[model samples]
Target: MLSGLDPSGGAGIQADIQAITSLGCHPLPVLTCLTVQDTRNVYGASPVDAELIRQQLECVADDSTIHAIKTGALGNAGIVDVVVEFIRKRPDVPVITDPVIKAAGGGDLADDALITAMKERLFPLAEMITPNGEELVILGGDADADRAAQNLMDRGCGSVLATGGHGTGVHIVNRLYNHAPDPMQWEIERIGGEYHGTGCTLAAAIAAGRATGLSARAAIAQAQNYVHRAILHALAVGKGQPVPDRGIQWER
Candidate 1:
């Protein structure tokens, strides 16, 4: 379940829903914050109280057999704490976390302390944590992606998928590192334009794959393909950036 809802239909729960549905899995969304924004940027955001989030999570968990979860844009420490609590109960379920530090238009999504809270509390529980280069710098305190991912792994995350969008390169290379045999790497032809909610789409696709019982390596591979296809057909909803068309099917 995601931590926020974006009304723009580009990111947050909207994006999650689209990605998960495209993968043929049911999405169980639990909103922890409400964001006011268009495709351009986040104008304002307010988090739901921890108790309310807890109630929503409890209700969902009780009513349905949740297969997997994808989390994005948790607004604060209180929300992180509550989410961590909920995740702790479902130790067997796979959890993919898209660490949302800033918006596509550079708006702050979480404070420094909130980031710390996530590193300490939530990172350990994640089956995979997808962070862009900028977010890795903040959380891993290292400029090198490999070193940064290692730092996160030491802290407890099962794997780190460091996306190459924020880096300077001719090709976007996403690296998956952890306790696996070796790191899995995917190099894709870099799309020319900036796309909003790509990370959210990737994480949700991974979650859907995991929910359907794909192994970690297979899930990551499938998710990368889905994300690339979505971005290739991204929708230009606003002036700032294109939003991923998560419904696009990757036909062979």
Candidate 2:
């Protein structure tokens, strides 16, 4: 997994670890950046050196049989380039990319150059790219969801999972576009109260599911269900937005 380090443990690589572990996969996290923030907001971020990230990737690859890759909050174009190159060599690995452009409480995590790098290089290698509605608009440069998803597909992304958590509605509608005649969608009832790390958890869960041999569609469904449950049991750890209970026990 490639992501930033969150000191608060509400999101970033911390969330990825929780979600992946909850789903029975051991997480091999490589920090792309270090964030200065709490549960309320992100004050700033410092990206890790590209060479250091490369070394970490190399070390992990040498020791483990990686089953899947999950990425979140890559801080800059240089880090994106490093990650893209590493992923390029592992063509068979299923990659679930959470395009975290902005923090949950409103702070830019990635700049324009990094976004461009992701679109031009990283996104194409992904098995699935999970973007919230606003991110879809920015990445695809289109207001129309379908058009935006199509735009991303044209850029070589294998599939796009456009999350609706940022959209205003009675139900959160998550749509998956994979070049089929019709997209697969799930209408989840909106759970009230803002929650941190939902995106990271969702993407990580999907990657874990994929690692366990679930198909893309099945993994998405499983992840959606997992996130919904996590949100329902969200933890009120700080002043702003609650954190998803990624480690919450399932109701038997």
Candidate 3:
């Protein structure tokens, strides 16, 4: 796992760890940046030294037999470059990237340079990218969801999972675009109220499913189900948004 640190434990690496562990996969967490944030919003962020991130990744790689990689808020272009280089060396591992451009509370987490780096370098290396509707539009550079997904695929991304949390609707729709001509989609009943760490939890759960040998389609389906259940059992941790009850038991 490569991501930022959220002290509130509502998102970022903390959320990744919880989701991965719950799904029975051991996480090898590598911090890319640190954020001063809570359930309400992100106040500020600072990227960890790129060299330090590289060293952490190298050390973890040398020590563990990595099954999957999941990345979240990489603070800058330099951090993205480091992650890209690390992923290049381990081509066999499936990578699930959550293109975190803005926080759930509407705070900007990434700028143009970092976004460009991810589009050019990191997206090509990922097995799949989990982006909400807004992120899909920004990254794909098109307003239409289908066109945006295609633009990403054209840029060498293996697949796109456009989530519907940010969209206006009665049901949350998540679509997966892959080798098939038509995309696979799931319409989950939209749970009322906002929840923090949903994107991280869903992406990490997918990584865990892939690590445990589930197919991409299966992994996506199961992960979405898992997140829905989690939100249904959410915890009122702070004044802003509820945190998913990731500890809710589920049969593996």
Candidate 4:
């Protein structure tokens, strides 16, 4: 299940649906926020009612054996509280949370209270939290990824995958930090050009990989590879940034 729903199919739940299905699992979408935007910028947003969200989650949970949960762009504190309570009931399910605090086009996705709630309430329940360099700074309450990730881990999160896409460099490094002695890292040649939905795609792929029985570490690696390929074949659908071609032909 995914929380944010993008009408443009550029990111959020639509991206999650595509990525999850591409990885050979069914996508059970649950919308926590509604985004009004194209591929370029996020113009506005409105969160779905918390009670309505509860009903949707309960309905899905009752009918399906959900293997993994992916969350993104939770718009407000109300939604965060609702999700935290809901996930508390299913401690066995793996949760991959893409901490979407801002849009790729520089729009605010969450308020201060929501961010605080995520760190205080949501992080502890996550199997892994994926945050880009910028978001890591906010979540970690520090300037660097290493320090920020460590801060979050100390706050009870199971693990942190600090994405390096937002940083300037020849290669993009995605680092994974968990209970192990050392954090694992994957360095990929930077793909030229801006693309929408990469974070959503990566998180959903990780969830699908986990749902299909890959171990957490293996799932992270596989998901990274999948996102790379998707970006490699990304499409210039809108006038703004290109969108990752999640429908690019591939075998699972």
Candidate 5:
């Protein structure tokens, strides 16, 4: 269920659909929010009609195997409640939550209450939350990636894959943290840009991997690899943002 993005065909549900299809999975989108901006950043956002959101879900739920589910940019508290409740009912499916609180080009997508809702409710329902740096700070209450991940786990996430793409460093550090046990891994790379649709691409790739029968860990790894490759072949499609060449189906 992709949310908090517009149908600009550049990011959000548009990007999610492309990423999912690139991996040969049909994207069944339940848009949770809508935006009024483009590639550069979001200028304004509106949550999708709650009842309409449910109707869309019902339209596809009974007819699909729905191997995995992914969520992005739910900008408000009420909508978060609806999404959390939706996922809660589907416990067996792997839920990939991309906590998008801000845009890559710079903008606020959620307020304190919405952020708090994510921490207290949505975090627990998530199998794994792929949060950007700033979102992590709000959810974890600490800038330290390790500490923030633990805080997310304490809120009930089975795993918190804290993405460090926004953090300052020569290499990007994407860490998968299992709070219950002591296991973690990081991916470092210096070759990436401020690409558009990055979060949607990653989360949808994970969902696509899961739909194709990958376990949580395997799905995460494969999805990360896929997204990395997509970034490597990103295209400057817009004046403000570059879209990943996800259309090119590359192999690793």
Candidate 6:
């Protein structure tokens, strides 16, 4: 995993590791950004140096059994470029990128340069990029949902799953589009609550599914279904923000 830090462990790499582990995959993570943040909002974030990133990737890449990868909250363009080049060497691994643009609690995660870097470097390297409604807008400024997804395809990802969590509707809708397969839409009722790291958890869950032998489409479906439950039993970990229990079903 590549992501910003979450001091509260309610989001970012902390959440990704938990979600991946809960889904029965061994979680190996690489942190791209260190952040001063609680569940409510981010105070500040700085991406790590590119050399540090390359060193981490080199170390982790030594492990031969890692079959899948997930990325979230890269702090800048430089980090994205380094990661893109690294992944190019392992085109066989399934990569699920959670293109997180803003904090669920309303803090901005990427500036213009970083956003451009994400589009140019990271999106193309990913097998599937997951962006929520707000992120889609940021990823494809002025493009609507369908257009944004298409733009991502044009930019080179094999697939884009543009989640509609912020749109105005009683039912939360998640849509997935592939360059080859027909598009599919999945909807669930909007459970009333504030949750952080939902996107990261979802992406990691998908990666975990892939590691466990599911095809890309089946992996995504399992992830979507798992997210519904994780949010339903979300635990309030901070005064103002909630973290979904990746083990939501463990003791139920």
Best-matching candidate per lDDT: 3
Per residue, candidate 2 scores C-alpha lDDT tens digits across 116-192 of: 99999999999999999889999999999999999999999999999988777789999999999889989998998
lDDT of 1 by residue, 28-121 (tens): 8888789887788888889888898889889888899989988999989988998899889999999999999898788888988889999999
Residue 113, candidate 6: Cα error in Å is: 1.7
| TM-score between model 2 and native | 0.97
Give RMSD to native, each candidate. 1.5, 1.2, 0.9, 1.1, 1.9, 2.0
Task: Name model 5 segments beyond 4 Å from true.
Answer: 168-170, 180-183
Question: Which ten-residue region of model 5 has the weakest summed lDDT?
Answer: 1-10
Give all TM-scores, in the order shown.
Answer: 0.95, 0.97, 0.98, 0.97, 0.92, 0.93
Model 1: residue 106 alpha-carbon error in angstroms: 1.2
Give candidate 6 misplaced runs (Cα > 4 Å): 180-182, 250-252
Q: Which segments of candidate 4 are over 4 A away from where they belong?
A: none
The Cα local distance difference test for each model comes to 0.87, 0.92, 0.93, 0.89, 0.79, 0.83
Q: Which scores better on TM-score, 3 or 6?
A: 3
Total clashes for model 3: 0
Q: Judged by TM-score, which candidate is best?
A: 3
- The digit string of per-residue lDDT tens for model 6 on 1-252 reads 777778899889988988888887788788888888887788788888988998888887886567898989888888888888888888888889988778876778889898888888878888898998888877866467788788778888778888866566788888888875567888888887657888888899899998888988888878877888888888888787677878765321
* Candidates by TM-score, descending order: 3, 2, 4, 1, 6, 5
Report the lDDT of model 5 for residue 26. 91
What local lDDT does model 2 show for residue 93?
A: 98
Please write out the lDDT profile of model 5 over residues 1-252, one tens digit for every residue. Answer: 666556456778878888888888898887777788777878888877777777677668877767888888876888777777778788888888888888887778888888888888888877888888787877888978789888778778878887766677677778788864665666767464577887778888888888888887887788778777877888877687777778876563
Question: Model 1 off-target regions past 4 Å?
Answer: 180-182, 250-252
Q: Against the hidden true structure, what lDDT does model 1 obtain?
A: 0.87
Better of 1 and 3 by lDDT: 3
Error of 3 at 39 (Å): 0.7
Off by over 4 Å in 2: 250-252
